[model samples]
Target: MSNTQPLAGHVVVVGGGVSGLAAAHFLLEGGAARVTVLESSGRLGGKLYADEIAGVPVDLGAESILARRPEAVDLARAVGLGDDLEAPATTNAGLWTRGRLRPMPKGGVMGVPGDLGSLAASGVLSAAGLARLPLDHVLPRTKVGEDVAVGAYVAARLGHEVVDRLVDPLLGGVYAGNAYEISLRAAIPQLYEGARGGRSLIETVRESQRKAAAARQDGPVFAGIRGGVGRLPVAVAEACRSAGARIETDAPVRTLRRTPDGWEVAFDHDGTRETLAADAVVLAVPAPAAARLLAAESPGAATELSAVEYASVALVTMAFRRREIAHALPGSGFLVPPVDGRTIKASTFSSQKWHWSGAADSDVYVLRTSIGRHGQEADLAWDDTDLVRLSREDLGEAVGLTAAPVAARVTRWDGGLPQYPVGHLARVTRLREHVAKLPGLEMCGALYEGVGIPACVSSARGAATQVLGTLRRAAEPGAGQ
Candidate 1:
């Protein structure tokens, strides 16, 4: 594999989400002769959509990038959006449990507290629950024979109160999943590593914190585009085009097949059918869609991909007078535990979180509430008007605000998040093993590594690298022999 021009031939990336766009951009950067992106919808960004509400631009889909990881931020800068990257005004988060807002405890891994003093001060846990925490050190070392549920393991050590109140809300915010079912290794890798460490979970977390602090990682953990995260795809698509890549919206891939030279991709555009042959192919769509396209080629991999489940949720963005809010928003947002029995699971004070989201007059306040979760889809059945009403009702109850919203918009994201259940990593490993047998073909997205913006971009880069490696090997003498 000595060839310098590893990706010298045509490559086609299916799906126009951030992952696919990143893949196309990387392929072009890797010296591919040509790259084409096929997006089924009329739009480019799949889940990172941007729209205006009350004359203010707000993200209807993914709004933040976990800036701690360099993938998403680096991709943004590579696409000429470095000047527009903006960090949150505040990163403080709150927990709405026990009919009150409590400061989220610091030094917790997925809500598993590493410091006793912070947990005690936060008052998120009751006296009984707080008393149960010290028992973790005295109790015998809990054996994690294999992968276990995050809730089950944490509850065994720290008690269920922590899992229910702090952990559930945080996990739900990201995955829309139940903590009792989500995988430890896949969802929260740091916590999983700490759990397996020889020391107690608390000690393990404290040690991890010490290491991080010594590294002096000081900055906002998240970043967002000034306009909206939706601008990311547009910028990436532009970069791909500048590098001579073709991006086609309204193009849905129907089938993918292996050819003697490389791959044959079939798709539809504008009510007409067409086919394209490429030296390599990247499938960056959701798991279900990828499964359908791969069914004829590898049934085992397709079955595993089809088994991957998704969660749906809706966001209700509302505009209100800043003075109308009864309670002070000390933090960017507050997370509501499912145990709270509230209609909304979480809410974000967009104006406070990002400066660009705020109104010029400072009288208008913009915020959004999230509804529905992994096992909870009934709430999403309501129409937009009903959703807005329900969101307002919950907001009023939480903060005692009686004023009505001036304008509201409801955005429903069906199958927005992929759930990672126990054994998910194993299934992903098996899927990759099967896929490796098919040269010049690769896949990447939220279903595999993680569901965050950074993870998706990282996965896409990995797929592009794998395709490049395959191309390099094929160009080598006696590669197939």
Candidate 2:
């Protein structure tokens, strides 16, 4: 092992997903001598892929980043791709209720009843359901400090109507996990704070609304790259290369070990075994993969990492002639409440949601349907053909598509999204503590904090700063001698 000084040595970033890529980009920008990104697959971006279908670009994995989360936008700007950003066509999404697409109850913050009149007027709740909502005003506030499942929290305050009709579908669409198993505190801290702040959730929401109304406009609601989200990773990779970072695809890390000098990373590249030594290392892979890489040195952390469960999901893209569909696909997308007993969880009007895809005269409509949630038994069972067939059937029934699709594609992600269960934050906190004990090491990915693109970028940037600080400290005399 070479006992080179930390500042003069390399930083190896495991995994080339958005998190890893962002970490490498930050490290390079912070003046790291050499940054090497090791991607497990042939591609750099882990789940971000945009492919052309019938001459139209379709995103298979991540679709858009919330403009409210400035991390992604800032990173785009730093990479010189900020000009390529495009806002979402519409923010209005609805629920498939009673065989009709009903607009989401207005003034509700992700399904929490912020306004009773708006919820009642939306036609989502019955007279009894509307009556149950006011009970929240009188319901006793939770006194426990421990985490509460989203299901219990919403059910207790807003009634089951709010949980089943609104929160479940909205959260299910995003996390793809059971509301009963998701922690309200971990999944949505703002909602939890609001609940704890006042005696009633309705009052809390009213206060939040006032604050939001008073705040100045920040930016767009959501934005995506002109072509697709995949442009983000492409631009990040280009930026890393320009900053003298080495990126190698198909270089899956097999193991990471701490040595007297620094860290050693063993991986395979094109059927050959290779090892690289670095002063610092960032394991930015998914929880499972990162766990495997760090299992030897940080067994406790690795164990906690491996404990985070991931749900398999498949994105089925179908295209049709505009005239072939009966209902006009409005808004960005619509989510199916679990009460609907629908195999399709959510459907995004791809062409209508973005400005780039659809044309007025083309008569082409694209739909991206998501299937398989955490507890929902997958109808297709990981088979691409079956998934596509199920998606088409569900879409046809829901959207009144009488004719077969003009084009169809399926992207299956086995264990793609990490499930943020009830105890997610505590588990992550423990893992972070364990990781901190391991010198020159960091972990960042969708599993730890959030699943969104901006969250991943934020994690990467944070990890990079920590790693850079460690390197700076070690460069001091007698620090790592």
Candidate 3:
């Protein structure tokens, strides 16, 4: 093999999502002789999907990239999409609770209020809830041994109202999980580290706010491409092909096995069964699929992966005439607290969030609602027509938006978000330990790291690096001596 081609042999990446595409790109860049991507579905991009609504393209899955992190942004620029990046017009979010819309309290970490003045002024809490705030300052430190549920720890320090109104809604937006069950360390590591320091949460949040203000980070917290985030996969895939990677759709891997030579990946493509031997393999599919594929090699990893749970949800997008709506949208969107018994958990004023989605003189306004979360899948059982109707009813009540929509579309995502419960970090540690035993085998995706696009890309890139390192070490002269 040539000196530049460290990972010279063939490599296969199973799963055509952004993670898989990213793996292919990294592998090709790392000098792999040949690479192939196998995707079960006819399409790619997984949850980073987009579709047209009212003649305007809108994201049906993850729409925004957290700009605070550089991974997703840097990747987009690398793939020739730097000029297309667009920041949101607004970032304000309203909290719907107790029969009115309250402005989200400022100076909070994951909805944990840092300043009592802002919380009290926002009217997010009742007199009793406000009264409970000072107790956090004087009360004895709540013991958080190794790790604890975010809700349990926050509620003990603050109160249940804060957990329900603030923390739950915020956590739901990301993981669709219950704060009472999510691990503090895994879900909200910053807050977890603060709690571990033994200082009051209020003090911790205030300190965080002080640091944030000192830095004064400018621009929007999130950014999106002009067409849609879904375009990301297409661009990345094209880049991979330029680097000589083959992408195959409608290819579902049936089994994976480790061999003395390297690895064997068997799959069915176009009504034919096929197997390919590779110097390395990256499993970029979901947890369940990965667990099944890894079972033959490492049952322990499979068992732990099987134990991981996922959350499913649906997005209902509707287009309405601006004149038909009664209230002007003060922010990009609003979050619904679960305690309010609303069918829709959150609503994004799409037109307002992304300038390209609508025009100032345009008659139609596009907005989308998210429904169903962990333990809230019953709503998803209804048909699309019913889901659209329920979303309209809730939006009408929440924002006095009684106008009939000009057009509507519903997208269902089954097993979309993964839940990270207490002790999840420890479980992941054990999984990694077991996975390390098998060389030339690596796994990546939302199941192993954060659910956002950046996290998924980071995971995929890390896997590529690991496999490449192994191949490099094996190639060294007198390697086994």
Each model's C-alpha lDDT?
0.88, 0.82, 0.88
Tens-place lDDT digits, model 2, residues 270-323: 899999999999988878888887788989998998898888888888888878
TM-score: model 2 vs. ground truth = 0.95
The candidate with the higher lDDT, 1 or 2, is 1
lDDT of 1 by residue, 280-348 (tens): 999999989999999998998899999999999999999888788776766888899998888899999
Q: Which stretches of candidate 1 lie over 4 Å from their true place?
A: 1-7, 359-361, 477-481
TM-score-superior candidate, 2 or 3: 3
List where candidate 3 sits over 4 angstroms from the true fold: 1-6, 215-218
Candidate 1: pairs in clash: none
Order of models, best TM-score first: 3, 1, 2
TM-score of each: 0.96, 0.95, 0.96
Candidate achieving higher lDDT, 2 or 3:
3
User: How high a TM-score does candidate 1 get?
Assistant: 0.96
Which candidate achieves the best TM-score against the true structure?
3
